[model samples]
Target: MRRMDTKTTTEKTGETGDNAESPEGAGSAGADIAAKTTEPVEAAEAAPAVEPLDADALGPADEVDKDDDEDDDEALFPDEAPASASAGIGGAAAAVVSAALGVVALTGTWTGKVVAERETLIGQIKTSGSGTPAQQISEIYADAWHSVALVNGVLSLVALLVAVLVLALPGRPSWVRAVAVAGAVLGGLGLLLSVGTYFDLFLNLPTAGS
Candidate 1:
């Protein structure tokens, strides 16, 4: 019976020790788990502070990116000219036409008419007799000259209008501007000559055989 009691007591002691070891092991495992859980948070707190992204620091780079995008957009259409440049070319064409017409009217058509009419009047004067016939021929020649001069004056006025149109056009070329100025000068001179001839301001033609 004593041997049986000794064996029983030894089993009880082993059970108590197993229970104590299990509790210690469970507490140590819980402590390890808790440490693992909070270790990352502690490490994060101990690390260096991270700065926020600064928007102003990227401003120049963003502007460069925008400039590149704009360049790409502009390069998309390689053949088309700007609207203002096209308009300037059209204006130059108009100026050329207007100036050319003005020059021709003042120098070619009106001058030819004046020369022809003057020749006719001189012929009539040379062939007239010293009488009422001569007087009538002289009067007719004077009237005809005045009428031709008036017609020339109207033509010069038309040329002046054309010159003004040329000069007023937008973005004319240098040559076009020069032509317009020349046309204006010639038109003005033609106008003066026409007025002078019409009023007989500078001319004294022989009349009635004189």
Candidate 2:
């Protein structure tokens, strides 16, 4: 009977140990779960909040970037800018040339004088032998005068046409247009004078009999 009681007491002690160990293990497991949940919540709360971007705040920066890109493009293609400038310079030069031609037509160029002298020499050769005095006068003096008038008229016409072409073209500068207009006026006046001289309206030829 003493041995039986001792065995019973040992079984009871083992059951008590099991019960105490179960509660401690359960408490430790609950603590671990609570710690895991609280750590994640604390981490989420400590992290910085993200804000949305504003369009108005970025507008000036975008515009500045666009302007810089345009400037870079201009720098890369520098030759393109000068092409239009060269064209303008060419137009201006053409206008000046037209004006100069008009002045030369009015003032009588060396070419016109040389042409007149050549015609005079030709007339003298043709009238050397048996032409009448009237025929000689017409050949020598009238032909030479008409030749000069013809050359002047041609030069005046060229100047007038060039000026007209410049005026007709689009996008001419103010100074170019002004010069072209002056050239046209001068050419027209020169052409009129040349016509009068050619027709003997300005100066009549001397009578052969006289």
TM-score to native of every candidate shown: 0.56, 0.71
Expressed as tens digits, the lDDT of each residue in 1-210 for candidate 1 is 999999999999999889778978889999999999999999999999989989999999999999999889889977777898877766566556555545554555655566657756765676566537555555556666776677767766776777778788766778877876776776777788879987889897666556
Whole-structure CA lDDT of model 1: 0.73
lDDT tens digits, residue span 43-75, model 2: 999999998999999999999999999999999
> Model 1 misses residue 62 by how many Å?
6.8
TM-score of 2: 0.71
User: Which candidate should be chosen as best, given TM-score against the real structure?
Assistant: 2
- Residue runs of model 1 more than 4 Å from their true location after superposition: 1-25, 41-76, 108-140, 161-172
Q: How many residue pairs clash in each candidate?
A: 0, 0
